[model samples]
Target chain A: MDRAIAIDVSHLSKSYGSHVAVADISFQVYAGEIFGLLGPNGAGKSTTLRTLITLLTPSSGTATVLGLDTVRDADKVRHVIGYVPQERAIDRFLTGREHLELLAALYHLPKDEAAKRIGELLKLVELESHADRPAKTYSGGMKRKLDIACGLLPDPKILFLDEPTLGLDVQSRLRIWDYVRMLKARGMTVVMTTNYLDEADQLCDRLAIIDGGRIKTLGSPVELKVGLGGDIVSVTLKESAKIPALESALKGQPAIRAVRATDKGLDIRVESPEKALPAVLEAANRLNCGVEFIQYNRPRLDDVFIAHTGRRIEETTPSKME
Target chain B: MKEYWQEISALTMRWVRRLSREKFSMLFTLVQPMLFWLIFFGNLFQRAADTQVTQAPNYISFLAAGVVVMTVLNNGLAGGVDLLFDKENGFLERLMSTPIHRTSVILSRFIFVMAITSLQVLVILGVAFLFGVRPATGLLGIAAILLIGMMFGVGLTAISMAMAFSVKSHGDFFSVLGFLSLPMIFLSSALVPLAAMPGWMSFLAKFNPMTWAIDAVRPLILSGWSEALPHVGMVIVVMVIFDALCLYGGAKAFRRAMG
Candidate 1:
């Protein structure tokens, strides 16, 4: 049996004046699945999430959460959805427990229920020990946990987490990952946007790689990698000048799909690295280019991104792109 | 309807809880208007009663009503500062993304401002009473004073919230607020009677909502219900119209900002 759809967005487009932020993006998130939107800064990931959460209205097209129109039935959609914004939506003056209780009330939970849920959420986030402390005194990770706890107070059917672990330490990020897994086990549908490629690869059951306000690719991590249909072979040559001879020697081989030079090595894409390595070694010997290092590995999400965009995901981001 | 009230009360409690933690700002908001009444205006007009420059028995009693309105004005106008910070810090967006009614957000802000302003007005009245002033209308008059102050406050709070949504930053919000508040205070009957002002200033004061509020409230402190009732009714009418227009504008701006 097919799973129920938790979120459905179709031909959604958002624009600011003449600049389109989300351009005709379409996707569906299934119930009880962790769906990720992987993109660089200014790639419209947050904009799409914001529109679905009803914080923003789309310029054109329609989005629905659990069959409630995001624009027409915005209030109803909000009622059933929890949103953790990219920015820390925390009040420094309030304690962690106070924040949760306030959100519980805002969600219209009963007083007794709110209290019980707050207690459970604090424990779930492992913030029970410091729940009474002012949020201003909490570290970045602690604050993020508080934010996620606040979002979970409504027991929402769908949760939208925008960069849930952005700017966190490794330990804090791992903790958040665990919480997300736990949430999925409890049958909650989660839609998250992240810049961390590995995090998306590991946590998201399926993801859409968005860039330039468009969905470039969409599939499970393994499926996306397999779709690239090539293995990556990196060869470090003793001199950069020898790259030209190596390329010429391997250019006519059918197994060798593509070749590109990097700062330290030549990155070759091929149908089979096992079959392609012998030809590469022979070419290196004939060209008098010493091979300092060589390795073959399966395509990663980064490789999939590079294959689709012709540039690394990191290179397309705001800081690196500039 | 019950759910609306529940959401409003919940959101209002958030503001109240934050306000309670901010001891210094709470103290300042309550005490600043009283200082103006007791120290600045009170001493300056010390001999006005002797000269019959004022209609009341003393300047403190006449100024007491104005002080109450001023307190409401200050609180109402500054009410959006918290909202501006909320918008800046993303808290407002968080609240907006929830299942609560959107109007409840703005309504709760008005409620929180009115509640705090009512307390400040009481403290100002309590201080004026210590200075030998008694409202001729007594307890009923105190109720009228609060009603007038709140009516005026609702209009001002609506305008402030509108500005908070329209402006881009807190600095711009504050500058606009400062530009409006001082002129509004001087142009109204807050500091002195309209009769004492120049002809043009008096004419302008007639059009000022703040003037209408002070006019309505001043009689409650100095005279009885028979004299104060008409102005009180007029102030309420003005406030209703003013709040309707301002709230409509604020809601429009808020919607645009959310978009």
Candidate 2:
């Protein structure tokens, strides 16, 4: 689709000494779209965000925000973008109102404009009552909301959020998700990095799954999931040692589309779980492997990550279950 | 240019607000040195200090200059503590992400430290007055004293900021702060006249920037401009060179750290 590009990155790579944090990666974020860079820990998402925001100088290639080169025109770029770092950046001594006030002044908002905007942000984050209290007293979720408010202070055309909801309760996470949707509705371009599969599935118009500083796949969540193309039958053997036997047993079957080995089980994609389940169990029984766990679901982002990387993006199964 | 100063002042006000909110910290920052050092050390050395060498009527008067300079030295060297904490806690990174000039962060700290140093100097002098010590050149001399402290302070504060950005952690910063402050204070003629120091230390004091400051400030408090002017000129020259090195090195370290 033809759309104005908010961010354009080409051949971007960043290194700390000899260690490459972000390898040659490139993508364009269209204006007014919620874009996501989905990756595991240390997957260079933060580095890429920092580079686009001009906190870092890329080791190679170039990035532009609204056509302004990130390095050559960083000052201009700073004017048009707001950043919410992964770290808790609020000054504990400053009240929430004071934090917004300072951010306003840094952004060079005029006196009247800043006051009005600060009031609006305080209200927006629902920190109005606690705005006068020092941030040290605010709960973790409240702090994260304040952080989002700070990023929104400049009313930036593009917002770069590094793990916006890294750690929070379900309610807080939902509030943040709603806030993100509101920003998108307001016609703001948001580029966020997260490892949460569901967050990407629910929030992003498009995503680039990155691993080991490389982009593994890039597509809309539905498009990528559909690209994987079937329902998956997850079978966990009582003994994980029998995984290879199950893998070979399930392979070359009539209805089994693909057999991908996981740390604890085998993910077998099939045209129908009904057709595949009986075949999977019969093979497992023949191989003397007890079926400790079995699950069936339509294709998931987890499957997409596994499909590309030959490994899981998240640490465990409960991450998806929860 | 206007926006730059506006941002700088706003950031400076942020530091000021933090200082003012903690009433206890504010009270101690203003009054602690007077109670701990000016009253005790000044009175203790009264009889032992020689009027001929000190060139002041009593030890308290001579000690006033030391206290003023000492306050500046301490405040200047420790100016970067808040900045270091900001760096550690990620506020500095957050601030850096904004459009404001990066130097504003460091410059604002300098402004805050020097401003506090001025108030602390006046408080010490007011208490010193109760002890029967008065400046020979009066109000103008007081202004001159403040200027000397700031000039001397600019260099020290810049060096402190450099340390903040250069070091790996706050623990490292504080250790270096202790390592530098004790030797610099003891080696300078802050507590005693140059005549009282051992030959080697006296020779070393000749090179200490703190010496140039104390030598300059002492005359302003104990003597008049004629004697104070030459020392002031020497300190101005010394501090210009000192601050130049510090600020240059500080800018470099800041860029490296932030990058």
Number of the top candidate by DockQ?
Answer: 2
True contacts kept of 2: 0.78
Off by over 4 Å in 1: A1-4, A226-229, A236-245, A261-266, A287-322, B48-51
**Steric clash pairs (candidate 2):** none
TM-score of chain B of 2: 0.95
Estimate every model's Cα lDDT from 0 to 1: 0.86, 0.88
* Residue B226 shift from truth in candidate 1, angstroms: 4.5
lDDT score for residue A77 of model 1: 92
